[model samples]
Target chain A: METMQPALKNGRNVWDSVNMPKEEFEARIERVRTAMAGRGLDLLLVYTTGLTDCGDTAYLTNFVIRLTRGTLVAIPRKGEVVTFFEGSSRGLPSLKQTLTVGDLVAAGDLPKESAAYLKETKVNVGTVGLAGLKRMPFQQYRTLTSALEGCTFKDADDMLADFRICKSVRESDQVRRAARIVGKLTMFLKETTFEGASQRAIEAALYRQARFEGAEDFRMLLAKPGREGCSVGPADYVPMADGEKVIFYLGVEFERYWAEAIRTFTFKAGSFVEETSPGIISGFQQLCAAMKPGVAISAFCKKASAVMAGKGHQALAPFGLGGGIGLGLSEKPLLTEETPGELKEGMTFALRMTAESGDNYAMVGNTVLVGKDGGIILNVEPARPAE
Target chain B: MSDPNLKLEKTLELINKKGLDGLIIYSGGTCSILGPSYLTYFCEARPLGPRNCAVVTKDGRVSLLVEPVWDAPRMAAKAWITDVRGTSRFTDDLLEIVKGYGVNGTMGLVGGREMSEEVYAAISGKVKLEPTDAIVETLAREKSARELEIIYRASRIADLGFEAFVGCARPGMREYDLTAEMEYVMRAEGADDIFILISSGSHNYEMHEPTDRRLKKGDIIIGEITPVCEGQFVQLCRTMTLGEPAPVVYEKYRMLLHAFAESLAQIRPGVEASAMSKAMNQVISDAGYAKYCYPPYMRARGHGFGIGSIAPGGVIDDNTKAAFERLQAVVVHPNQYIPETGYLACGETVLVGINGIQRLAATETKLYVKEV
Candidate 1:
């Protein structure tokens, strides 16, 4: 999650009607409208900024901001939805081709543009539910609130997160497709030769491989096998030595859906053999099996912690026990000691479990879909390396 | 560009001058070529979390606070500050750290604009956070000797990126594939971050995110290749034709090349930054496309790239009031929508000084032709 932000998000750009149809968006909007009706809200503004924070708006409109810019979706109770994004007015022509919504405006200033649009549409005066509006830079937030003085705004981030925590059939399919890409790339990594190659060279090769595989955005962080820090970083320029083990924290977004996969491999003679602790592997399998619909998230996390503590393995901290993974890499209902939530079916997340072998620390993880029966790991064999 | 000791001295000076208890250069993780994280400049390390700040107290002690609670070791390893603490509760820890310092006076916030409403409101409740972005901008506008060296290295990576872009441009390859190839080559050369926008067609409106559109015969591939090294970014813009370029294509691109040169010639310290844009526009207008100098046709002629400030800002048009300064890292491009050959890209990054300009990249600013 701490990977460097790529300047140009040159990924697979598409608005697949079959995979993520307009009807899907219509359904999402309707769901939000239903929530709005209960809250007595007249309009909902779901705003986001930058590549990482683009999820809230992207959920409503299948448009992601490639660079650092503001994007928002405005859903009024009684009218067609309109979305605004940060870009030059000239780009509106080409940008229009990418969005599911017909009424889209490309503007330099989002708050100003939203205000002007609302003033023109006469929807400025009302109680509006604001979601992810806190992600904006303070200046822009002030400008937005000042411009829409007639509207009373309530924070709807929790409501929005509750709705977005669960994956729909199409959303799950999109995640499946993204996870498949991760699986294929893991096979690619396992089979490839890293002999005499710099860590960055491997990173470059992986970037190329993922892009060619139709991956839109790719990020990988390199960590030494024994490294204790959870915030694994970008690759250094040094070549990966043979017999040296490395752990990769990799994530890719396919058509707006994200899937992250973590695996550790021991390098020898240009090839990789996965290194997995039998105890940790068995523990993770049991933990995933325990991830049922009615399982309390904190309890599950506490149990995982207890198991790890018993095995003399410590939590990896921030990147340790994983959380929800969907439009954003980390969503709500995170698996933590004190986070109040339950593992509901349809909630998707990156499930990671760490193991210790002597002084070395190793981790294995994959994108998981919480199911009625249990946690369904959305990965191929050897991705988890337990096979 | 100042050394850590010098930065501390300056920070102390600013705190004393402003009558403040401390200074906090914050990072809201809104880092890009458009804007570099202010905290990255102060800390000399990129904090991989959403909320990180460098806290400089009046006691001359500087401590870093990084989010995610696990990035502390990484920050401690690289940053000049010895006290690097990572916290999951960023807002709470930041407030606690400020209270621990125990100064009830005001605090200067360098990147106050970057903070979200949640963070701003949270900090405002306990302490008065005032925006001090411009003060740091004025302090760091000029590059240090080491930063300049890194900029040159980054520019070389940009050149390599264009070389890769040229090597990968071919018929039937997707635009994103070309982007991947270019990015890989740059990454292989140690470019920290890459920002590339590309579009392929016979005639183009503007450069955008690389789509699935494959290159075809006679397609004009335009791109903005930016390779960042340690927060210093250098951009290269080039337009290549898949096949033999038309006569009009050659003619129009030549004008852009001339405009680029004209713009470069005007880039010395103390001159109004608008002079460069005015010069570039004059060449295109003189070539009988004066009507295409404004928007709906063209955006900014250029923008400055720096550690903490992308000054002269995004659009360096004739209306821009800022003057070009010494050691300023700026990317000057005449990327425009020309009716004759669609949009042709031509630009270079340069270091501004008394010597006018030192070109960062070795890539020639002209139309590239990929042989059929």
Candidate 2:
């Protein structure tokens, strides 16, 4: 329960290596039960609609919906957990393969189905904790409340978020696996960039390599030095010109765990040169050295700011430093001055630092795991310095 | 590039028509190809995380609030809205923006269904919040020239996807491997997003996500190839066989092909959307599968694909009364499950034209056989 089985121990299948074992899920459920008891909640209902919100449900069941649909998980304080899927009955076969939750039901309408389940189980009259309430449709919330009749509902989104924000040994291992994929992909990107290669071809190379390495989900953000900023959508058809500056921020999810990597490069004499400053790289390494358990995340932000400033540089606010990474790509304990939390041992985070020097901007990002000793850089795709 | 200002103009017109102080349209969750993320329709930048909101003031001012903080740059890079800001706290930033527009009058809220209850309460506590999904839908039903261009490009990618699905189908290949190959092809072709579902075996009940199951000779494969380019989506539900040798499969497939052709023929400007379903159902009924024409057999004849503006409105059933308009894009999938051959898929996307439906897919609807 402390550490997860390694994804690639000795030349196992990529799929076999990357997937979470059943013990990991069992340990997670035990953790949730303990947290649920502390909160005096009888049942925890996790509702998720669409792709991004599935983190809450996936934490318990490992069931991620591929399409844009609503899904709910009802975890009782004592017994079996039931999942209400957003699809039809025909999806049961696929659902069974993807999840371990035994009591799976097909619900065309999630709210109505959940209400019926609550009433049937006679738990509708008790105190129920709800996560992902904000993501649910308003009408469904009204329906759920009306059906509960006498039940008192409380926001338990943070309860789940708080539990998931910190990674376990296994979760950290998954992050490492995901980070490894991101590292390899970024390296491929660096090697593939040419004077005339289109962004489409570059992204295609990324997709091919990441998926081959068993990445469940992959997202990319790219920007030219002169562009307004980076976007997480399609790559344009424009071919790269010689000496054009490009910045790439890539993230990948393996076995439902997340990691990220960012690098800024300029296409030079038929190659890519790391368009970054020694100050920024030093600032990043300094920030990593500063990351320790019990250090307030805000304090880390201040330290990052100071590190950059001492190096005659300034990092961007809000998004520059980092945030906790685990089940979700950007989890709580965000590394920002305004955030009110402390970094804990066993938390994995992505430190993305963007600095502006004159008319150019450079960014360096990598996933780091907070250990008892210090921070461990999980996905290390080192940049080749500018010539 | 399409003028992001065109959407700003439309939002202003909507605000004026609804007599609202401002409009708040939001997209929840970054992964939804078809969720209530109408913000993409207005801003052109679909967020990649949970919760992005756009505030359109009646005075020609538009601002976007993006979540996950990292995507802020992406939103600014892609969206036409000049006042895009990134935030870690979604509800607070949303409240701040809504109040900036004088939050005392009726505020039209698009994508209300996807809004969390806490967000709704906070906003409505300040003003009269009204759901503007229908209004956005009405406006989105007619595509702009730029929207059509993106949708058409997405359709061409869908065609390439099917070509991959066909070219890569062979015995001994795992379903997921086939999916990986096809997705690589589409992604290389500039498909920004894709949702592929595959089911193999001659007795395929329905299309599902690819599994570890390996294809064998004589096993038929069904796939729904959906690709999105710049928020515009195009889908094709096609079927292929590892080897040709089934009279009943083709017989059942021909019925679906006939239904598909007749259904597409029913498309024209001003036609009731339900007519497409009825025409499709009639062909299935003539083939003596009327009992199976309803749910569990198939739920939709086709659905409109866009950000959130035009859905098949509802599933294309006999009871639907929504009418088609010019420039609306829809996928006419007549994928059916019958006792004769289990299930078969045949469909293509089309653009509703002034006189007839414009087919986006060049691949004709038929039972494509891969020579083993």
Candidate 3:
């Protein structure tokens, strides 16, 4: 594989490097400050663990901790932002390198350091907003809470989630690059016949091809049409049979941005087994088509169920309809029954549809962007066999 | 089915022979237990959340104790071991299971190092808590043919990652950026879990986390790349020198290679693990670089690699006393620092056979020179 060159700013792509420039970042912080003032939030503590929930932290500060430890980004209603990361004296250089000179605190003494810094800086702490603290350990939460004594802790995950739902120009470019790679690999897999090959061999071939396509990270789950359950990875060595339907959920990461696409294939060219059945496909399409800027998420979910039922397939319950995707594989603004509000433009979601036919099951999903006209498919490819 | 049963029976017999009433396999979510990944060897699935354990008795009955009521059914189905029970609190549930077994006379805790203070106190009150790394280590050391196949595949993936790193790591790029690219490549290669520790500098002071420090001309980028496949661990540590390396750096690299050679030379069926560490230490010590052998300087010379047998015999160093056994996989990284050339990584994972040790990975041990 050859090295991937940094992307250049151009109108050829949906996004460019300019989306994440220092000026845009400063503007985003300003927007956060305005939102905080509106919500009466004096301070906002955004926590991220590993690569999973680091988008918020990375948005504010370009640093992403590689370890499985928590990193926090503290943004007061008015002041300089500060970051806390776990490490020893060895972390000093890294802190200096990744963070701005004025925006760093040793993670070992984070609570004390944050308190001292906040007090010295004289930032008001009345109503503190927190995002991504659901998985945060209690000790860390307690420390932050205790440090800001009179502040009322409120879940501002929605505030952060709202900001994350919309993809900036740079993020869209990265996702588009990742999507192109995934699309190329999916097409390659379709051409590569699987007869006499084990699942492991086929998976390995796909992985190798993805790397060749310049995907930074690739993950795939292969399920035979009539298989019992979703057995991801290359562990199962089931040999490919002529009539078996193969489904692949493929994801690729480019420059730390992730995009995913799901496709199904059959061995025979004309034999279109309901590899991810069309009934499920129609349901997903209806949901995707209905996703507009002003439509409530709950209403969209209801429409999804009605579409599934109308197609004579068991309506997939709320859990599988997918949600936002960015730095992490899955993000908020989830399409669940309890989801708070409306769909917005620039937001991305994976519209998933799964159905069971007797013993056989099939699923088809695609990442989509909410456009003014309708949801646009990020990974565009023919669903049927090539003539 | 019968093979696993027979193996369990033989293990139980060995337990009887060793005069231990029961073996307590303790695993918790921490750096010591290395998180839930190690539990996959016995349970066939990674444990979720805090402390959970599977205790097998001399009489052949097994019980799995876990926290949180919701995880019980999932653990039971995934582990393929019925008699799965759980507790809201780990300490009380652990005590109940031990008392129920009636073999609480002398218990051997597999991962005693990571047991919580509350759980340890509860168990020690009723049963004698003996710290024996043998229970899990012995089970993990001998990989079944099926397990070996997974490790072999994982090693191949690691090689692919190294190739990816070689292509992507360049001057004017930040360490974290390279790390992100490498991880993204590995994920694309279908790697489920990756533990990559890397460093880059003109002189790599120590091998630690990735930083945003931009690589300069003639910098050395060292990486200890490990990928987890089917819950098995396979690793390769290599150093890449950007542009032409200085004479001193090359000499230090040669010394590290020599130290690794001395360690590899000591591997055999009957050789003690400590002997191999001693041999390697002597090579560095004789070269007047002995002070970097232990703690305040270096953590470990080498360590055993597998699903759950990370520290059974302890990390290979001059103080190690574990004996080499057939099919025991170990990685020897004489990854040390020299005042002249920062940190040099020279290591390979090898499997001990009857006659000698065989390298698991096919990557070359020599320093890779990446042209800027």
TM-score of each: 0.95, 0.86, 0.68
Task: Give the candidate number with the greatest TM-score.
Answer: 1
User: lDDT values of the candidates?
Assistant: 0.83, 0.75, 0.67
lDDT for A371 (candidate 1): 88
Point out the worst 10-residue segment of candidate 2 chain B by lDDT.
Answer: B28-37
Return the lDDT, model 1, position A54: 74
Best by DockQ: 1
Q: How far does residue A19 in candidate 3 sit from its true spot (Å)?
A: 4.5
lDDT of 3 by residue, A190-227 (tens): 65665676665565566556655555455665544333
Best model number under lDDT: 1
lDDT string for model 2 (A237-348, tens) is 7776787777777878776788898788888876777776777777777888888888888888898888877765565433367687877767777778898878788989
Model 2 lDDT, full chain set: 0.75
lDDT of 1 by residue, A37-74 (tens): 99989998888877776787888878777777778888
- What's the DockQ for every one of the candidates? 0.60, 0.28, 0.12
Worst 10 residues of 3 chain A by lDDT: A1-10
Worst 10 contiguous positions by lDDT, candidate 3 chain B: B29-38
**Model 2: which residue pairs collide?**
A134-B116, B304-B312
Chain B of candidate 2 versus the native chain B: what TM-score?
A: 0.95
